[model samples]
Target: MLLYHTIALAAGYLLDLLIGDPRWLYHPVCLIGNLITLLEKGIRKIFPKTEKGELFGGFLEVILVCLISLGVPCAVLSTLYRYMPLAGLVLETFWCYQLLATKSLKDESMKVYDRLKNGTIEEARYAVSMIVGRDTSELTEEGVTKAAVETVAENSSDGVIAPMLYMALGGAPLMFLYKGINTMDSMLGYKNDRYLYFGRCAAKLDDLANYIPARISGWLMVAAAFLTGMDGKNAVKIYKRDRRNHASPNSAQTEAAVAGALRVQLAGNAYYFGKLYEKPTIGDKLREVEPEDIRRANRLLYGASVLSVLLCLGGRLLVQFLV
Candidate 1:
């Protein structure tokens, strides 16, 4: 069974590297997101508009989403594995492929890079808006570039490494659970008035889910920086010094490493939902960020992703040996 899982994981990683999430295919995350939206609305109506009520509702949402996210995949894989092991392997491989966002992350960030290289400032802003959660209306060229770079950096953990780790530990089912937690946080984990209470549970769960994987991503990024001919020593320095610079515990881990590797300032303050968020900058501002930094960030992302695969497989092998 473990051998089959190994084959599935390797095949899935290759599939993701070759072709990322296509726009035409209906993604599982879409279903997860819709479920969250529906449940949020229902919870708002059923639960009273109070702190405790919202908290309980949020907790309920967390439980329900995670269960369904994990359960459905488990059921499908179990039934298939029982009757047709090869078919089960194929489905699990595809599910693992869908869960990873390496090429897709690079593709989306490159959209901003391409626009910045050949289009108007407004066009560049619009390109970046598709990838980041921050406002884009007033971002300067450098701001836009940094935002794109930061998205690649932060998501190196969330969109790639964390999911990869989860999938390796428990295959597609557990990864779905991680994605459920992540999707909930992405949707509801805001510090705004509307979600400050209602989204607290989801946000905290995401923080916990990403905790180890985020640290592993930070170190892997540092290693990748060296391998990719970036400033690796600085990557380590900045990672250690500023890994906790963000409001979210996991977000800054890889961002600090990338910032140091690139020697550019990132994460200084940004606007979200028509409001300002005062955030401390990560890394030293040794140079101005350029459009080229986006490419460099993607290179680092790919490097870290490869390292994550090796590490996960190595761990699995060691565990099998011990068992």
Candidate 2:
């Protein structure tokens, strides 16, 4: 089982690195997101309007989404493996590929970088807005550059390393479960009046799920910085010093590392939902952040991703050998 899983994971990693996510293909996360939306509508009607009621409803949503995510994939994969091992491995590899977001992250961020390099500040803002949760209408070129770099840094963990970790541990089914958890958090884990009470469970669950993976990602990114010819020593320094400088326990882990490696400040105040959020900056501002930093950040992302997969494959081999 471990041997097959290891093979599938390696193949999937190569596929994602080569092609990224294709616009032509329908993604599994779309289904997960659609399910969350459908569930939220039904849950609102069935549950009361009170705070406790919404909390319960939110908890219920988490349970249902996670169960379906894990259960459906497990059933399909198990059935296929029972009747046809080759077919099972292929599907699992596809799922593993879909779950990761390495080249996609780079591609999206580079859209902003391209616009910025071309001196199209408005277009750059629009491109960055697509990837970031914050408002982008009035951002300066520097703001857009920082936003692109920050998304690339933070998602190095959320969108890449964390999902990879889950897939390595329990194959694609467990990674699906992680995606469900992550998707719920992305959709429902807001702090505004609408989602504060209702999204409490999801927010907390996401924090718990990402706690260890985020830290591991931070360390791996530090090593990646060295491997990619960035500031590895400063990456370690900022990772330890500023890794906790976020509202999220997990978000700052990789951001700090990237900021340190690139020697630019990140994670300052930003507007979300038309409201200004006062956020502390990450890393030392040794130089101005430029459009080129986006490419550098992607380099770190790729380096970290390569290191993570190597470690995961090594672990799997060690386990199989011991058994």
Per residue, candidate 1 scores C-alpha lDDT tens digits across 1-323 of 67667777888999999999999999999999999999999989999989999899999999999999999999999899899999999999999999999999999999999999998999999999998888999999999999999999999998999998998899899999999999999999987778999999999999999999999999999999999999999999999999999888889999999999999999999998898989999999999999999999999999999999999899888877887
Off-target runs (Cα >4 Å) in candidate 2 are none
Model 1 lowest lDDT segment of ten: 1-10
Q: Where is model 1 more than 4 Å wrong at Cα?
A: none
| Most TM-score-accurate candidate | 2
Candidates' C-alpha lDDT:
0.94, 0.94
- How close is every model to the real structure, measured as TM-score? 0.98, 0.99
In candidate 2 the C-alpha lDDT for residue 116 amounts to 90
TM-score of model number 1 = 0.98
